[model samples]
Target: MSARSNRQIVLKSRPLGIPRAEHFEIRAAPVPALQPGQFLVQNLFLSVDPAMRGWVNAAANYSEPVGLGEVMRAFAAGRVIASRHPEYPEGALVMGMLGWQEYAVSDGQAIRRRVTETDLPLSLSLGVLGLNGVTAYFALQELGEPRPGETVAVSTAAGAVGSIAGQLARLRGCRTVGIAGGADKCALCLSEFGYDAAIDYRQPDLPDALRQSCPDGIDVYFDNTAGLISDAVLPQINRHARIIVCGTASVASWDPWPQGPRVERHLLNKAARMAGFLIWDYEHRYEEAIAHLAPLVRSGELRFREEILDGLEAAPGSIADLYEGTNLGKRLIRLADR
Candidate 1:
């Protein structure tokens, strides 16, 4: 790759299940000239999320799939190196759908927001202060509606969004229970994220464990995994419980729509409310969530974790690793210094 050329990871093919490195290709292409109302960004950090799996799958999802031979769509944080737009002036810091590339040209619509929290690390715009944190905030607070003295259970409790949701429930005076894949993650939920109880879903007697952990019955269930883990949780919901369906990490393929135990009976019997949460629906309130979380982050009241790979070459396999539970927190790839 030449010094002036932009390096990118483009989609090579669609995947049958979890995306692997084989589905992507790295290529060097000349940087394009900025057009009117456009800005060029030199990306510093690229996010690796489970949602990327849906983005590349051939199945229909909330968003269209990334076309073959196109730059892998991704959230990236960077500083504007050149611009023909007034709002995105040169040297301004920003983050959004910048794709898996070292440099990106945007017309500002693809820009989610400008990075204004100068006191914090710019990389945070893609994690805690970005979509992950915001999603946790709205999904738990708005949809889950946790109350003091309630029992709130979170699946993938040691994960990026789940960890924050657990902490928020704890702060609200609710008893938080975390369900994770292994012993170490269960330990992480208890020790770091402040969960009252932690259950390892890998255990054969998962339903029994959930019963023991949430003895009072869960009043708010922040579900990230929607297969067996959900089957265990639905049976433990109390009357008027609020269940937030945030992510479907347990189910690899939605093309055939994996079958599971019926949940309508549980919801009807318990008189519980179940709703799906999409972060994009709450875009207008993004600043409200950031304003609320940033102070807590700086004051050490709110906590988070991140696992970062050193370069763009790591992007191809990062999503697969994320689904395999290799990442302890929000996963990101560093392309350059912020």
Candidate 2:
């Protein structure tokens, strides 16, 4: 293969809230030569996630903010086209922080894992077989500890992680209720993802809808949106209910820390437990989760969705679109074919 220039979407300016296309700029640069123990990756699929909102914000998140003029930080799946590294040899597929560029040079430190499931689409490594899937697996099982016949309520139930989490809960014999933005997504939650009940949070009577769906009260709540959705769910927790804090997609900024109904009293009354979940915390157990989820995906026992946008041009505004719920499923920008 011949060498070529790399195209990257770099952060042009920091945004106060949701980042738009104007905040980024596309630039061409010569692909860096591989150094000792380094490899060159031709990224095929770039991920667009809600967590990206925090990555571009001025506020410090779990990881450092993407610096100005740098390629936008993201998880991508790709093939190693050139290599000096023995482990990540040429032709090996990899997934990790490869950013929003067509080509990435890595020393393997930022590479999360090798794409071992060759039978699955390489794109799945960026979604269900990657961080999102592992996150849903660990957070729900370890933190929520849901029991059979219990009621499991999931916010953003039509999204990447929530959809998987809801399905996992259902497979465990728990009754699953999904909370989504629109009626279409709510319907998807029921028909596609197998949620027993679906609630449109955009409706005026969210609390009423939640109450009706979770008649026995919520035994476990997988919270992806932490604003109004959580407000309605918290008050309905059953005795010893478990709450998993996954993502804060609804709230754009946490600068002043958006205020809402206090949850101390609710937890005290119900003897409930709420814990935050970050996928990085469970990095060591990623393969374990993948081992369990892969077979289910292959057998069609587990279902997943993907919305692909062609070319790097889609990279700039994709994150904003994610927050607006424009995509039906896990969103990815296709830069090349695997």
Candidate 3:
């Protein structure tokens, strides 16, 4: 086999709000040959996400910052090229924190066992079948706990996690309201994702729009865009409401973290509970999520949407689109050339 080659994107700068190409550098890398229990992988699909921004910052968070000159961090699907370990064969496909690259090196432990079926499409493994899928599942089920006849609202309802949350909320017999940016996204939430109503926040009087869409009172808010949108739902919260803080898309812009709407009063008045979760906290239950979600997905009772870009070079821009809410669903980059 020819020696491994890589095209890796490294972080050039800490972004202000929206990331630009200047913030990244695409570099050609020579992969080291395999050693005992170590292997080389040709990446097939790259996962781009909003959380990547936080991963780059030196400030405090759940995970350490991606070093300034390192390959920008990411989760990806790749196929093994050369494996010295008996456990990892020469051609197995897998998923891990492989970053934005055409190739990755792994000791079988760094990356784990992979499923080889291409029938499901290798790309889906990085999204609906990967961390994104698990995040949506755990956050919704563990945090939201929707009750029958209650109202469940979600921001970014057309995106990866938000879309799934909406469907699960519906399964619980709740009135689902989706808050998305444009009218098109709003329409997709209702028509494609089965949301009962979609409020286009781009319209003036967004709080009023939310009110009209969720007239029954908000019982559970699966908040993906927590800022003003979360504020809008607070007053409408029923007695003993629940808020699952998933993402803060509304303040995705960089610089100083934007001030959020004052919600203490509402929290006090309603006795509602708001909880933020780190999806990895439930990593132990990842297989459980896949076992359950895969059936729903394959059966068509669930919908999967991916905004796939053409190549690794497009990875940084794809993540920028996620924070801007420009992409329709899960924003991802295809690492394979096919």
Candidate 3: residue 266 lDDT (0-100): 85
**Residues 1-338, model 3: lDDT tens digits:** 34556789999888766566788999887887667777777888888877877787666467997888899888888887788877778778888888888888887655633754466877777777777778888888888888889899988888888888889888878889998889889889988999999998778898888778878789999888777777778889888988999887777554575786687888888998889989878977778878877778788888888888887778766666677667887877876653
**TM-score against native, each model:** 0.98, 0.98, 0.94
Error of 1 at 25 (Å): 0.3
TM-score of 1: 0.98
Candidate 2 lDDT over 142-187, as tens digits, reads 9999899999999999999999999999999999999999989999
**Model 1, 1-338: lDDT tens per residue?**
12479999999999998999999999999987778898899999999988999999998689999999999999999999988999999999998999999999899988899999999999899988999999999999899998899999999999989999999899999999999988899999988899999999999899999889888999999999999999989989999999999999999897687998999999999899999999999999999999999998999888888898998889899999978887898898998776
* Candidate 1 segments whose C-alpha is farther than 4 A from its true place: 1-3
lDDT of 2: 0.94
Clashes of each: 0, 0, 2
Put the candidates in TM-score order, highest first. 2, 1, 3
RMSD of 1: 1.4
Q: What is the C-alpha lDDT of each candidate?
A: 0.92, 0.94, 0.80
- What RMSD does model 3 have? 1.8
Pick the winner on lDDT between candidates 2 and 3: 2
Candidate number of the best lDDT: 2
